[model samples]
Target: MPIFVVERRFADQLEASAERLDGINRINADEGVRWLFSFLSADKRKTYCLYEAPSPEAIRRAAQRADLPADVVTEVSGRLMPDGSPVPIR
Candidate 1:
């Protein structure tokens, strides 16, 4: 599976309310895409979601099904630590 970074920008404040999060989780159940994690900007205007899927198109489909914004989907090749060291995969 390839990892993808999905970016989304909100017009105003980005709210990650429990209900909205639940909705996303629900939509992901059968989308063939796994939601690894997400980062919400401090200003609450943007969100970056990390996902594992067969292709970027899968990620877009998941977002569309979840009714969430999918501004950009980029394929990522690696993950690293805050210290700039590569994180070992088990």
Candidate 2:
């Protein structure tokens, strides 16, 4: 699977409830996509999500099914740690 960074912009502040997350996760699994985690902006109107999927198309499909916005999906080679060390993503 490949790792992807997804950017989502919501018209209003996002409400991340457990029920909503569970539903999203279920949809993601159906598309072979895993929601690793997400970073939300201070205002909560924007989110940067990390996902592991077979392809960007899989993520898009999951997002569409979940009624979430997948504004941009880009593959990341790895991550740079706070210590300035480069780490490989699984």
Kindly provide the TM-score of model 1 when superposed on the true structure, using C-alpha atoms.
0.80
Error of 1 at 90 (Å): 8.9
Please, what is the whole-model Cα lDDT of each candidate in the order they appear? 0.83, 0.94
Q: For residues 10-52, write the lDDT of model 2, one tens digit per residue.
A: 9999998999999999999899999999999999999999999
lDDT for model 2 comes to 0.94
Highest TM-score: which candidate?
A: 2
The regions of model 1 sitting more than 4 angstroms off are: 80-90
Error of 1 at 49 (Å): 1.2
Q: How many residue-pair clashes does candidate 2 contain?
A: 0
RMSD (Cα, Å) of model 1:
2.2
TM-score of each: 0.80, 0.92
Winning model by lDDT:
2
For residues 1-90, what per-residue lDDT tens digits would candidate 1 score against the true structure? Answer: 788889999889876789988878777767888889989899988989888888877778888888778999998877798999986332
77 in model 2: Cα distance from truth in Å? 1.6
